[model samples]
Target: MMRRKSWQKNLKIAVAALLIIYAVEHILTMNVYLRKPMLFSPLFRVYNQSGSEPHCPSVRLSTRVLPQIALASYPGSGNTWVRHLLQQMTGIATGSIYNDEQLRHNGFPGESLSNGSVVAVKTHNHYAGKDYARAILLIRNPYESMLSLFKLANSNHTGEPSVDRYGKQWGTFTEERIRGYIPLFASWIKLQDVLPIFYDALKQNLTRELVRIKAFLGQSGIKGDVRCALRDSEGHFHRKETGITLEFFYSKKQRMAVNSVIDQMQKMFKDRFENIREDMDTWKL
Candidate 1:
């Protein structure tokens, strides 16, 4: 009996060792493949529908025209509003604004096709370690953004449990579960902690910002008035107000915490506050 027990312990140790080796090998292989540039080709191909040609119009537009204009925002900081504005300005709407599944699959509809012009893609993901020629980062007060996100995620029949699906699967949109996902939603959330990082980096340099934006837009040889574009886009969301107060679903303490988060965020992105100021200054109503 003593001999049998000893043999069983040895077998378990060997099995554990084999499992560890298998896991390490699998991880190494994945790391190697992920590090390869060719891996993104399939992803780009699916977006462009052009097989293996980097110079295809769609591919060229993606790489050159826009360079990279990731409309980075929390879950609902008016991304749809921005996307619609961009679409109207570009004169290409494949009717994708209303389709969530399509947006999830194709990234964004307006820019996915070979329009041969600058494309504006909306994403909830973080910057993927690529140098973007121009990027428009739209941020909202975190409390408002988070609350809006939670509400949106919970509303749809198709939506999964927020903590379980996004939290566990991708580890995003919350602090506790950001590690497993790419771009880690938690990092974005922590943007509230150091709002100054974003403001100082992006806002203080407006001329440089405009130059980068123009450079990206010029890649498609497209030129138009951005002010006019903003007007056209803003008109779409115009609705008659019924004087209804939008109530917060969170308790007073929760609301206060969210407000605090927004206050910190505002300080960080204070430079861009002028854009909002300019809008308010010109407000006719």
Candidate 2:
């Protein structure tokens, strides 16, 4: 009888605590659903209510008073993750030119980076735009980056494949693909002011990178919680389980293929690729 009474008390406490949390969520997003109807789900709702979302908040953060900044990278290089991190940090919308229709589901609409006087333009093109002041180049491990791209491409239902699905499987890479990657990898050098962000370094130590990034962007004093930033960057990903990377997902043959490609890249790019491979500590995941 005493145990039963204790159980009832715990249940009541749990119910009260849940109610309090729900009330808070509702208040934050109650009327917001109409304005930003995408602000449904009381659980993950956050809004500035007055402003539009951005396509690439970090890239377009105008270092100058005029013109836009380009956020350039090859697809699957964690550019989307960077966009999400920026959103959580600044409550600004981070969007993609290609995926605007889908970005809205995550609170970043098609016009997230539009309608603003100053914008951050994001592109996968290997070239720079004439109108931009400068660019921020984001990089990632080729094997994992290719895997991410493979999964993304295979998932696209549009029959045409998304982001140019490179090969038949996760681990199997190509000479042609590697050749394409070399140019994209090398393209960062063209920008007058390029801020190179490596994915492996970022996932391992985001707070440190973010500090560096904010300072590079001339907004070093921007106030935000490190815990929250980490949570947003780590959790906001649709494929956060870490199973899809080269470490586990790729087969022996696939790994061999990746190694050959890496060797080729290392021979060609030298320290640019090798240094990152050495720093490729993925323990944070």
lDDT on C-alpha atoms for all candidate structures: 0.42, 0.55
Which parts of model 1 are misplaced by more than 4 Å? 1-65, 92-99, 102-108, 111-118, 156-222, 225-247, 271-285
**Per-residue lDDT over 75-158 for candidate 2, one digit per residue giving the tens place of the 0 to 100 score:** 777776776665555444443446555555645543345323333456787764465556667877676666566656676312
lDDT (Cα, tens digit) per residue for candidate 1, span 76-108:
455655555445444433222134763534324
TM-score of 2: 0.58
Clashing pairs in 2: 53-112, 54-93, 54-112, 54-113, 55-95, 55-113, 60-120
The true-versus-predicted C-alpha distance at residue 208 of model 1, in Å, is 19
Candidate 1 total steric clashes:
1
RMSD, every candidate, angstroms: 22.5, 10.3
Candidate 1: Cα lDDT at 230: 29
Alpha-carbon RMSD, candidate 1: 22.5
Candidate 2 runs further than 4 Å off = 1-67, 110-119, 156-176, 219-228, 240-285
Clashes of each: 1, 7
